[model samples]
Every structure is written in structure tokens, then in C-alpha cells.
Target: MAKEYEFTQIIKDHEGVIFKITTIYTNNHEDQKDLYQEIVYQLWKSFDNFRGDSKISTWMYRVGLNTAITRLKKEKRKGNQIGIDQVIMKQTDQYDTEFEERLKILYAHIHGLNELEKGLMLLLLEGKKYEEIASITGLSPSNVGTRISRIKQKLKTQIVKK
Candidate 1:
């Protein structure tokens, strides 16, 4: 059907966004896959309701983030699950050892952040403007700017302490 084809194409085009979000929210490979599937399912479920009021990517980000955050909360209520401590680096051939180490450290710090901060940092790192980030996050542009400034300072202090 045309609807199915359109949905599949949209998912293919934005799969990286889903992957990044799942990676950021989950520690282990299995959990990441589960989250990824869940996000895709949620997106598909709401596909009919999309009105084109925003960029498709923005809508995807909002839906993906909300689903991830909600899942984390549900997971917490269900009790602690063991997470893999090792960082799994992708595309090692594209980066030097130094860059890989830096990335590991950065991800560790990112994982330490609370959920909201983690979501904000992911969007910021994606090169989204403050207004777009706000639209995705349901925050005002000024608040997004303020939170990003604070998160940067927090990350800098954390790195300096290491």
C-alpha cells in the first residue's frame, strides 16, 4: 500500500536518528535493538495522525525521545537490570585511537546525565538549532539555550575533574 511504502521510506531516511537515540538510551546491544524496534513501532502507530505541521524529522525526534524516556521510566519501576559496562565503538576504522578514547569518555559522561539532559545533548549534538530543539522538546527557545549552556559547563567540569 502507499501508506506502508511511505512509512518505510521515512524510516529508512531517518534510521540514523532512531539508532542514535536508542544507543544513547540503552547500554547493551539487546536493549538498543529493543528500543529501536519500539521506537519504530510507535512511529508507525502514529503515522496516520501526522499532519505535516512540522518537519518529519522533528516529529520523529519528538516521538522517539518521548518513547525512550517513557520506556526508561517503566524500566525503572520494573527494577534494575544489569547493563554492560563496556563501550561498544562503531566505525573504528574512521577514527584514530585518540578520537575513539575521547568518544568513549564523552559517552560515559553523557550516560551519567539525567534523562532530560541526555535528550537535550543528543539534539544539540545533532546540530539542531535552539528553536528546532525547543519544538522537539516542548521547551521555549530561551530555556533550551539556557539548559544547553548549563549542560556544556557541566560536561566541561566533569571532564576537567577526570
Candidate 2:
């Protein structure tokens, strides 16, 4: 019961992280739902081992990214190229046409990023600090900064080409 409660609390607090990671890795609604379930299961399985060494959200991000990467690689081995054409981010009621166009372009460039780059961008987009992103991604803080700079430039170039 205690573990169940803990898992429930984690889910309530960090479910958005799971969904966002799933969206970044998956191309369709069905795959997104499946990846979300897999992430939740992994979190539950490892919940007992969580030692409070990091924030729960941080731990969740690490686990979520690892699971998504593993799943993606496995699918790749099976010759699957999941194209992310489905728009997961809904336009708000007050959004202008300009915002919508920018959003589409953003998603396009995001889809062009590799798996590791996608993870980094997702973490950055979630407003994680450099240290936190480095910890989750097993990179040095300086490396995180450098990589983010490069990623931004790449994204700029991609959007410019469109």
C-alpha cells in the first residue's frame, strides 16, 4: 500500500514528463500510449530502489528517457522508422496563425533531431537547469551547455532550410 501510494504520487506529479517523453519518441497515438505504459511500469519497478538521492522528477526523467531510447532502438532494429507527423501539441483557443506555423516548424525540426538530441531538447524545453539535465543525461554540466548551444544552432539551420 505504501509503495502504491508512492507510485501514485509520482505519477500525479510527473505524468507530464512521461507523456512528453513518450510524445518525443513515438509517432502515433497507439505507440505513445504503449510507451507511456512502459514508462509507468519501469517507474513502479524501480520505485522501491529510489533513495532520495535526487528529486523524484529527476529520477523519473532519467528512467523515462532510458526506457524510450531502449524501446526506440529495439524498434529500429526491427526496421521501423516511426515518422512523427501527428501533432500532439494542440493549438490554444487564442493562438494566432503565426504561432501555429511556428509550432509546426518547431515540431519538424524536433523530429529531425537524433534520439539523444531529442532527449536533450525535451529536457531543455521542460525548463530544466543545466546541472539537472547533465545529471539526468550523464553528461558534464559544461558538456550540457556546449551541446545545447550546438543543438540550438542546428535547429536554427533546420528551420531556415524550411
Candidate 3:
């Protein structure tokens, strides 16, 4: 396949990763959509620079996360926001009210995390090993392990406080 075709195919295969990164950065649906578009745009611009040193998915996560964190900071600086009414919520399958509420609250806490922790936790939740997380984030594996432990403790404390 051509480079373009290969990139497009790989992106299609892992489309969920784009949204997963975006959602960690923004709860606002409009912000999420904007961030998603920007991540795709960044990915396209840098695709040629990707030399397959890591897995394509790894490359995607690195680019997607860097784009999201940059975009998030830009949005925060601009203080521009859409009205809640203008925000579009994606439909999800209905779960029992209690389960739904808990899921929502869990996501809320995840969203409250700082930029680095958000990426770390999201990667961990995706079942990335500490070494993989370290590779993506450029931290040492031991450092990644320590941070994940700390993050877990913090999240548990936060949950207890709620």
C-alpha cells in the first residue's frame, strides 16, 4: 500500500485511541471534537516523520497526546467555550442508573487529573505495561511504576473523600 493508504488504514484500525486521548483532556463535547480534529491534523502533518521505531499505535498515542495537551493549554488560555446547549453528547447504551452514575463520576475524576497523570492513567487503563507507558511518556519504567502507584493512591483517596 501507498504511504497515505497505510496511514489511513492504521488510523481507521485504531480510531478509538484518538477519542480516548481527547476525552481525557476535555469533558466538553465541543472541546473534544475540536481536539480530535487537531490531533488528526497533527498526525497527518507528522506522518512522514514517523520512522516506525515504535509500533504505529505507540506513535499515534504520542502524537495524539502531545496534540491534546497543547490544544488543552491553548483553550485554557483563550477561555473560549461553547454553551452547554450547543454541546452534543454522543449516545451510549443505557446501563442501570447506579452503574451509569458511577461511570460518570469515575470519568469526572479522571478528567480532574493533571496532564501527565491523565495520560499515564489513560494508558494504564488501556492495559499498556509500565514499560510501554514509559516509552510513550519518555519516563523510566521505574518512574512510571512509582507514578502509577502514587496516582492510584491519590485516586483512591479522592474516591473515599467523595
Taking all chains together, each candidate's TM-score versus the true structure is 0.85, 0.82, 0.84
The predicted structure with the larger TM-score, 1 or 3, is: 1
lDDT of 3: 0.82
Prediction RMSDs, each to the true structure: 5.0, 5.2, 4.3
Alpha carbon lDDT of each predicted model: 0.85, 0.82, 0.82
Q: Give the TM-score comparing model 2 with the true structure, all chains together.
A: 0.82
Candidates 1 and 2 compared by lDDT, better number: 1
Candidate 1, residue 76: Cα displacement in angstroms equals: 13
Task: Return the TM-score for candidate 3, rounded to 2 decimals.
Answer: 0.84
Candidate closest to the true structure, highest TM-score? 1
Clashing pairs in 1: none
> Which sections of candidate 2 miss by over 4 Å?
72-101
Tell me how candidate 1 scores on lDDT. 0.85
Ranking by TM-score: 1, 3, 2
